[model samples]
Target: MSELARRYALALYSVCPDEQTLEQTAHVLMDDTTLWQTLCSPAIQGQEKARVLARLPVLDGHGLLLNFYRLLAEKGRMTLLPEILEAFNEEVLRQKGMARCRLSCVRAPDAAELDKLRRALCRLHHKQDVIFEIRTDPSLLGGFTLEIEGVRYDKSVRGALSGLGRQLEERRMA
Candidate 1:
């Protein structure tokens, strides 16, 4: 499924006229759950789905992509929208020479905090720019965990307690 999505994304990226349009189209697809469901619903026909997609003003200037989207719906591959969006985002970042980091915390960060985090991640990766995906997971218990480039850094309270427990167990055995 993901491979198919990647292929579609690459095809779109290849023909995409401008990065801004690609970004806007991707945002529309990513943010519209109802539209996604409608597109993927067996009840909706290709013409109906095409009409709905055409109504979106953001996609107005992107005729090629809009048609591509219609084609996916017609072929019943509309459910791959999410994966295709993901791949498209990755392609955009890759084109821009940036890396994305996933940061999960117990609560949302303020603008200043987020900026600081972005800077820190940029420095950590030695990259001029970094993209961040911030999410709140209350189960983290406090603090946050950062995942990037397949490496994970766990600083949550649960992680700390687990480390402490391991240290105590080692001492008891000694």
Candidate 2:
């Protein structure tokens, strides 16, 4: 993220009350996949992108957030909306002392399993307020990986295989 983007995100994060609202706003901005596609389209010009962005109203935004979007659109910086939203979310999470845990599973875990995992994670992190955002990635083969903040617990089959491969290579060299 550029300094400008980070500044914008921080400004928004300061005003936004909760992650859900910020996430909703982000979803609205991201829902328009066509906008990004058009921006990347070879035939589109910068002026045209600005025009397109100008037409988009600030969804649920008041005061600062609204003004920021307008400024970005006016300056032809709309392409950075996703990045700004992501940065804003990170800032919000950090403020809440809630590290985001991204869990990718090969299949949807049962409710009981999810609860168990959540409890385990809460205990592991020693956090009274822990939040887990679960996702399913079939390509994981089996098991899953837990990403908390920047640290990763790679329990996925693919990760294990890669680790084993590395160990074998080291043994061969030694």
TM per prediction: 0.64, 0.67
**lDDT, each prediction:** 0.82, 0.71
| Candidate No. with top TM-score | 2
- How far residue 155's Cα lies from its native spot in candidate 1, in Å, is 2.2
Model 1 — TM-score against the truth?
A: 0.64
- Candidate 1, residue 146: Cα displacement in angstroms equals 1.3
Local error of candidate 1 at 15, Å? 1.8
Tens-place lDDT per residue, model 1, 1-174, is: 278998998888898736577667756775788877788888988889888888988888778988988899888887887788778777787777677888999998898998898888778877668778889998889999988766799989988989999999999999
Residue 69 displacement in candidate 1 (angstroms): 0.8
Model 1: colliding residue pairs: none
